[model samples]
Target: MALARGFADPVHDAQAVFRTVMDALARPGLVRRLACGLAPPAPLTPELAALALTLADADTPIWLDPSLAGCAAVSAFLRFHAGAPIVANPAEAAFALIADPGACPPFAAFAQGTPAYPDTSATLILALARLSEGRGLGFAGPGIRGRAQLDAAPLPPDWPERLQANHAAFPRGVDLVLTAPGRVAGLPRSAQALVPEEA
Candidate 1:
């Protein structure tokens, strides 16, 4: 019903959020908290809202998950604040926002940029129940020295396999930004997502 608020200081806040996102992406599987406070509609966390604000622009087409799409408040907030177009087709989107990661389509369904233009691929922003250290899946890649683990509960069962497959695509796969109440984590296409071994 009511329109949501954007950052208190647009320029500075956007820059701060953007920096946090860059840090998260640089260090895969590491969680970073956003200082900005936002109240987007249900299913969209503040972390996710901040992320969209920082990344999405008028030229970026965003694909919203069914649950998020159905919420008028969320759509209005995003449209008014981010000025990002909402696209019906996932493949055409530059950013895909998923409120329920377990209910999301397979990772392969989204756009995977061509080898010559890997930056054209879509970035997935997922809202998770919570994020913590050393519990769910393992990660190792670029910024990681050895290995890093993420506790992202309620993720899709096939996420590890999918992430590995995505990583295997090398220069042509989508990247992921996992968000919680106030924290976010990166799962770049270059990172390897490993299943925990039996204890």
Candidate 2:
């Protein structure tokens, strides 16, 4: 498809998406909207579409859980422009894009840091919904003096526990990007994640 026929050229759109991600990461926990242009296959939202364009590149190897694989056409798209390799498992992935964070596997199932190279852990980009500030919960850690509230939806039942376990490893847990329609918030492995107390 050509940009001439109501189809946006991906390379052109990727630039804007890149800016969104770069700035979002630079600021941490801030919300920024990204553009989504892919005529993405099923189970894909604009959030996930924009993310695939922005973060994937030649140097990265991405692992897509079953939820995301039908678009190998998109995979071919990545290989052509970004040269990013697609891998079979999370352990082999530099970046893992999760379509449904709620049902996504535990952090332990994916790669954590090795003693020699703690930074080897994965970077997870999660496509989420109901993006709002973590208004009710008190969140603290790097980049905040006391407690900072940012939008953080609840993950799986054990996700909070898993994140705590990941944090205990410090420089080892995966870095995260939580995204919605057009906005995103990052939870660097350095940040402490606390689930809200239910009312």
Candidate 3:
């Protein structure tokens, strides 16, 4: 049902979502779950859809990959809820939400900001099965000092390679927000990831 019985639920949910987002960004390497339940359609999972609702608006430009089966459904929902502009290509997007990362465009194809204002790069929000945990690639950098693992299953073979290239761009590469069933993690501009050595 609708959450707004009064001022309390909406206020609380908003605070919770905001807190989750803040935690994701603040920690940088860990995934924090958002409270999700707003179903849009197939392929565009509830958690991802909730994020779109929480973070987007008319000012944001979003790009949707063709892999998401509910493009029309998601587009209509976004138009109704966020009023955000939906672009046809990834390069044109400020936020490109991808349900299937394997088919996603190469990192070089997206906008890597010019030297003057390298921070103008795009943010890619990818829908994942889990954030990251032990036995996976270890990450370290700005927010992380030592190392930590995540349960990032079923990504493209070259995802880490792509990220490495993106990282090399210094201040110009795309940032990432990986969301799963209820959790998400934000990988910002300053972090670096180290893949585990295979024994």
Candidate 4:
């Protein structure tokens, strides 16, 4: 099978994507656009593919959700572009790409860093259909002033509950980076996802 093309300018594109990702993580619910123009394999959206290319490296172990894992093209793309090793064990993954959020396990299922080394925990990159503003989960935490709203749908009904658990775990929990067609958002473990009643 022919491999797809990655970033047009590898260095600058990766740096651009990395900066956008960091900005999103710094301000929960904030969305940033990416224009790397990468055409990775199926089930790998440009946004997620950009993330993989920007963040994953030979030293980072990646875990793909069932859908992404079963797609040979997707694996090949990651290997060729990201140069990251694919790991079957979620607990061992430095980054976990989730193409099917509904079937994704709870946050606790992945690696939670030790209290002494919180930064070692896994970061989850979720591929969503889209992200909308002003009407989803309420967010508040370090980056947020008072509260912020984000709507990334097609997620499991218990997403808020799961997020609450993730937030409560604090420095030890996995952080989330959500991706749509050309945009991305972050939900760091420090950010709180308020349930409906609390919103």
Global Cα RMSD, each model: 1.6, 3.6, 3.6, 1.4
lDDT of model number 2 = 0.69
Q: Please estimate how well model 4 matches the true structure, expressed as its whole-model Cα lDDT.
A: 0.90
lDDT (tens digit, per residue) of candidate 3 on 91-119 = 77777888986677787766677778885
Candidate 2 lDDT by residue in tens digits, 1-199: 4221111766667777777786666555667776665556556566765676667777778887677766665566555545689888788787887887887777766778786897678888888776666463445687655665665554677766776677778877777788887678776767676776689
CA deviation > 4 Å runs, candidate 1? 196-199
Off by over 4 Å in 3: 1-15, 196-199
Decide which is better by TM-score, 2 or 4: 4
Evaluate model 3: give its lDDT: 0.72
Model 1, 1-199: lDDT tens digits are 6777888888999999999989999999889986777777777778778889999999999999999898888888999999999998999999999998889888777899999999999999998987887766889989997999999966888888888889999899999998887788888898997766679
All candidates: TM-score? 0.95, 0.80, 0.86, 0.97
Error of 1 at 198 (Å): 8.6
Model 2 stretches astray by more than 4 angstroms: 1-15, 134-136, 195-199
CA lDDT, candidate 4, residue 126 = 92
Q: In each prediction, how many residue pairs overlap at the backbone (N, C-alpha, C within less than 3 A)?
A: 0, 4, 5, 0
Please name the candidate that would achieve the greatest TM-score relative to the true structure.
4
- Steric clash pairs (candidate 1): none
Residue pairs of candidate 2 with colliding backbone atoms: 132-151, 133-151, 134-150, 134-151
Write down the TM-score for model 1: 0.95
Please report, as a residue range, the 10-residue window in candidate 1 with the lowest summed lDDT. Answer: 34-43
Candidate No. with top lDDT: 4
Each model's lDDT: 0.88, 0.69, 0.72, 0.90
